[model samples]
Target: MTEDARWLSGLEEQARARLAAPVFEYVAQGARDGQTASRAVDTWAAVEFHPHVLRDVTDVGLETELLGSPVGVPWGVAPSTLQRAIHPDGELAMARATAQAGGVMVVSSNAGTPFSLIGETGVRWWLQAYLPADRTLAVPMLDRAVAAGASAVVLTVDTPVVGTKYPVGRVVWDVVDPALLRVNFDKGTDERPGADKALDLGPHDVDWLAEHTGLPVVVKGVLRPDDAVRCVQAGARAVWVSNHGGRQLDRAVSTAAVLREVIAAVGEQAQVYVDGGVRSGLDVVAALSLGADAVFLGRLPLYALTDGEPGVARMHREVGAQVVETMRLSGCRTLADVAALHAPSAPNHP
Candidate 1:
């Protein structure tokens, strides 16, 4: 195996060994038969690069901006719940690592760490939320996140209801102390009817979030080009192509498969980001080439968090270095160069 593959495999082994079986499976397994989850990474790998040769390769730049703020890299952490279940330090450790690495961390609404603590770590972060059936139930959380300095609000538009995983077995929530997952919400507020995830999330909810938070609304879990356009029309500042890391929908299309189409539809209207199955720096390049402004890492960072703060720091360093090396080898210096290399061409005349 390649060095990168070996390193990732080793990390996964360590995570599996350290975490309880249910916790590990909760992070590792996808819905149903795991077909979409398994295919997500392979789809990225299937994209072949036609590298340029004999160009300057001395310095490769990896800097970029997400939603107007500069980030040291074009990739960041995707929001995931129950991080404390993975390690004692949880999201706090992740915030420290991401801050040190100069990347963003999108905090889950169900985050174990308090938003204020995460903010104190100095990471450029965004808040990810699922609008409850009663939208007002989200107001306090949104107010809290903004007060804690969240730069954006990522609305996860999938999961009208949580998808069913096969085997119907006890998962991480069943085995862990439920308190670890309830730290973000007020006492018993989470169990209230207003706290249930909304079933009818539509484009207007995008405008509502933006108005309520006064923060850029990033519509996540979008896979269709038309849906992307609708989100932009409804005032979404960005549309994230994702499949909930293949956890919410068993056989949904991989983000890699539809990134270009989504970008094509709304590239001019808003920034485009993607997550799900992005495990390598090469995968980052492929997504950027297909017009994605940024790529987000989902399960990879969580697995690294198994080793705590330093493990996540190392993951950022390694992946960032890999991106630089790939860009240098491909005769590209900047993110724009990478995008230009894969720019769409005009049709030929007969």
Candidate 2:
């Protein structure tokens, strides 16, 4: 299927068939047995919606606020590494497409293009950061992003070291050329690490980042409710409930399993967001019904990147359309109605 088909499955098939084997595997698979990745997808697929038929559901809208930013839809693109590995246009293409769809694009700290260049596209964007061995190494990049008009700083806290990639049966490195990963940092030096390099960061690092940056800070890769509480207490503007898209740790609970608790713990204090194996609009509604302010999408966008900006735009519309349709069928006129009608069940978390 072509980009005009506007189907996610087609995008996935196209991306897999077109991308080089290593790049496809690196972007598509998870850590160790890939069970967590499989689980993330499976759990989302299990969400059951109770559609109310008596209400007049002529209009359905999916607009919402995320960390105070007005999002046209209830979902946005989660940060992913090595966009250049999937398409020649890379992060730039994704940013423009997201902007066209009136959604946010969280630019990865490991983006092939410099943050300023992506910012130059005038997209509504945030910078996804990795705390370095020396915090000083991160200062200039952050300052430059703010100067270039990034909306927020999403500080990822889960990866202290790279996790094993079971498909390759090793901690596979060099999946993306090291040269593309360095353009955003250590510009003139030979000392910068590759895109897959792990960060030595923890919750307290949120305090340090809050003190340092003028923009709002959202902590990503949090799965436990207690950790979610700590993130808000440490002054995070939002908590991104994720398991590194199940790429960082094997046997980790799916985000769907732990999201309700994390939202209950920190939703009132900070904006709660989630992303993992969220492939459909029904999945978006499931997350919203459980109290997520917004949901971020991962692999699907990379799959769309195989077809460039039009593909990305199509995916955005496709998902948004799904959300609107689901909302209509479920007898919810707005996101608030969706949340009010559904009471979430607490899931077991790791």
Candidate 3:
């Protein structure tokens, strides 16, 4: 078998075995029956691609910019908690792979290695944060991310509370190692102190982050149209429509369904992105066709890491390869073409 195909399927089984029961479950399970989780894939599957007949296939480029920074491709690695559990390299492995593949990597607020420790190079870094109730704790983390050289900040708004994911006769949370799950650090250090300011994001908190950090601010986990509008008015440079992978709320709309509404709210003033159940190149196509500037992969990268750092690298390479092939076969020549191509959604739900 070709290296990509061999490694692709092999990682699933290896990941299933390497991860401790609890670690695997927490990463694998979705909320409730995990219907939303399953729906993530189904929704993408329902979007058909209409390939153009006469486009020149040679020299297609998948490059694009997220919040003004160049990225090799529109696809990226989403932030999840604790990288070390899956591999000794943890986020560093993923970070390196991101650089190697020429994609973006959004590091978690709770990253095991402080963002400063992970080098910024060929890959662009975006900071992913939870608006913690305690500003003292939150501010410093943001400060650290800034010091780490992050180009943008992604504020995850759906995690008012953590998620519960039960998958196929298993309560996934019960199996993951609790230690690895908490990637954020203990408070009382000298990073900064404005996390409490984010408890109920208003113009004050939002403006401070943008004005103080000088980083492009994007709000994540926003599913409502009004919320999207609020984020933009509050100075959001972009909006990332996510249900936290259906890991936080079971009833949230599929990421694909909400893309247009968020885009409409921002209406060219800001860019829009999506996460959750974005598993393949076709899935990437689905989100972009609907108007997402980009999409993030939270679970898939972690799943690959289960076999160690090399596994994660393998995953990014193969996935990047898949996305390139998908782009070529779809008859799109660039990220803009992917944005320009449109196909009607399937008549019925899968």
Candidate 4:
């Protein structure tokens, strides 16, 4: 195994040993039968690459832009909630680690840390939100995120309601302090009539968010090309191909399986980002090869956070190093070069 892979496995072992059974399960388990979650990693592994051998690879660059903002690497941390259950530092630790690595972070709407504190860390971040049944309830949080310096808004469109996971030994919400889950909202927000996830989400909601927040909106959880087209047409800056980490839909297609189609559908109208089963530097290159503008990590960083901030930093360093190595070995000098490596008939090909 590669060093990063081994190190990640070790961290997972450490986390399993240190965390409560339910907390670990909360981060680890997926929806019923876990079929989609189980297939994600292998689906990415199944992707084949045809590397160029003779090109000079001595100087490789990993820099790229997301929503027009520059990032040091092509991969960034994806948003996940209830991080405090894994570590005391929670979102602050993640922000610091991501800033140190020179990558962007997507902060969960249900984040344990305050928006201002996460912003204070100097990591470029975007806010991920679920529009409540009463859309007005989201205004305060969106305003707070913008005032806190969030670069963009990622609207997660997959969950009308939380999915049913196979019952764990213990549920995370029942065992952990409720205060750590949604510190960003008002005390009685959950009990309010409009606080539930909106079931009637439509393209108009995309337009409403952009008009309301005056920030670029990224429609996440899109698996179909038609859905991607609709999001971009509705003024989304990007469409994230995700299946909610296989937590929302058990049989949902893996991101790796639909990235090319989504990229093709959106074309240059907007950027395409993806998360789900991205585990290594090689996987990052593979996604880029398939036409993804950037890749995101969901569970990996959380697993690293078990060791606290420095552990997360180390995880970034390890993955970054692996990315550099993969670039050199594949004979790529830039992110654009990685896209060129795709086959002529590939959906991303011009």
- Index of the highest-TM-score prediction: 4
Can you write out model 2's per-residue Cα lDDT over 1-350, one digit (the tens) per residue? 22343476566788889988778888888888888988887788777766666877888777788878788887889998878878889998999999888899998877788877888898889989887776777877777788878889999888888778766543225555776675766664336543343355666778777778788899999999999898889889999999988898999999988888998887578998999998877788988887788999999999988888888888988887788878888889988888854654365699
After superposition, the stretches of candidate 3 with alpha carbons farther than 4 Å from their true spots are 1-10, 120-122, 165-199, 344-350
lDDT of 1 by residue, 203-312 (tens): 88998998888999999999999999999999999999999999988899999889899998996889999998888888889888777999999999999999899989
Model 2 TM-score is 0.91
Please identify model 1 stretches exceeding 4 Å from their true place.
Answer: 1-5, 167-169, 343-350
Please report, in order, the local distance difference test score of every candidate based on alpha carbons.
0.88, 0.82, 0.75, 0.89
Give the per-residue Cα lDDT of candidate 2 at 334: 85
Model 2, runs deviating above 4 Å: 1-6, 167-175, 188-200, 344-350
**Can you write out model 4's per-residue Cα lDDT over 1-350, one digit (the tens) per residue?**
24545685476677888889899898878899999998988988887877777989888898998899889998899999989889999999999999999999999999989999999999999999999999988888888899999989999999999999887566787789988877878778889998889999999999998888889999999999999999988999999999988999999998998899999988999999999987777788888999999899998898999988998998898888877887788788999988966674345555
For residues 1-350, write the lDDT of model 3, one tens digit per residue. Answer: 13655566465566678877666766777887777877887888787676665777677787888888777878898888767777777888888878887888998876777576675543578888766555556666677777778898887777766666545544444544545533445554324454342446565556767876898888888898898898889998998898888787887789888788878888988988898887766688778887889888888888887666577677776776766777778777887777766764355767
Backbone clashes in model 3: 12
Ten-residue region with minimum lDDT total, candidate 1:
1-10
TM-score of each: 0.95, 0.91, 0.87, 0.96
Q: What are the clashing pairs of model 2?
A: none
TM-score for predicted model 3 compared with the true structure: 0.87
